[model samples]
Target: MTERVYYTSDALEMETDVVSCTRQEDGRFHVVLSATLFHPQGGGQPSDRGTINGVPLLQAIQDGHTLVHIMEGPVQPGKAHLLVDAEVRNLHTRYHSAGHIIGLAGEKFGWLGVKGNHKPGDGRIVFDALATPEPMTIEALATEIGALVQRSESRIITEAEGKRLVTWGTLKPYACGGTHVLNTAEIGDIRLIKMKEKKGQLSVQYELDA
Candidate 1:
């Protein structure tokens, strides 16, 4: 398994040994490193865009316990340097943290969070409110979430059991594996753009002006 350095530190670059390099059918090389700072595409967050040993990193994905970094050029099986795009990482971190805040807001309004997406420019959180006693408007939700953001009191807490939790202010924690900003204040000016209901599910779309 690749030691995921991003989980502990926000370092965008690292030097690690290339464990294996296999050429795929698509002609891209699947490179596995002993440790990596790249966050793979999972849990609604997109993959990190960067480079390995100066070669463009096309994609990063998890294969069981190991992370395979797809590269445009072949990387030799040896020590290599890994670097991630700071802007992309920052954008993803802020959006993912915002998702957690939106989830807390949903819970406050008696909505049950069922799904979420943290893709930049297209972030949203879905909730099931089949038993909700009252209708939730975008304005009300924005007010609630905006309040939390204004508090700027979010943190990433890891429990003894190794469960990663994202907490927004004093709200309850939500288990998450995606990258996030150190504080909710970094997610500036959140806007609830659209809300839709279908088949007992509420899709609340949002955007961040950072």
Candidate 2:
């Protein structure tokens, strides 16, 4: 049987024991713990950066349904301290919120397949669609996402509920296991970084303020 994953609901520092860890066939280290604040990689969000008993975390990918933190170095389980790269996580959180704003805009504009996109680099996101949008003006996309982030709408819904909000015809609701800002406004200054067509698909990229 696979091990059970543990996590915390709050972001504050709290000690958690590393219960167990082992090597997998795919070369990624599998870890389990009494609790963790580190968010696993999923939903277009990269894994949390951190260390385990002095070992550096490279990335995280979900193992079936469990949250695993992939690390480099020796790690023995049993009450190991938990640490998280809060600065990186903060940026990821902003990117995630920005992704949602794009989803909302896609819906308002009758675009489909807008969710389920995350470009891995510098907190960028891509809103994909089966059909290309008429080349949008930067200010137009910015005003849509920026206003939402500025509004900072406060709503914490479950996976089922979140999916319900961004439902587009024939498009599945995205389900990601990453930490997100409480409101849209937390994702400030999202710019439309790109738009491209490949094999008839149009992808819209979001730019993060440096």
Find the candidate with the highest TM-score and give its number. 1
Q: In candidate 1, residue 183 scores what lDDT? A: 81
Error of 2 at 161 (Å): 8.1
Q: State the lDDT of candidate 1 residue by residue for 13-61, as single tens digits.
A: 8899999999989898999999999999999999999999999998899
- Give the poorly placed runs of model 1, Cα more than 4 Å off: 130-133
TM-score against truth, every candidate:
0.94, 0.74
Off by over 4 Å in 2: 1-8, 23-29, 119-138, 159-175, 197-200
lDDT of each: 0.86, 0.61
107-197 per-residue lDDT for model 2 (tens digits): 5544554345554354444445534455555567667666666665674534454342322232233455556666566667777767555
**lDDT, residue 194, model 1:** 97
Weakest 10 consecutive residues of candidate 2 by summed lDDT: 164-173
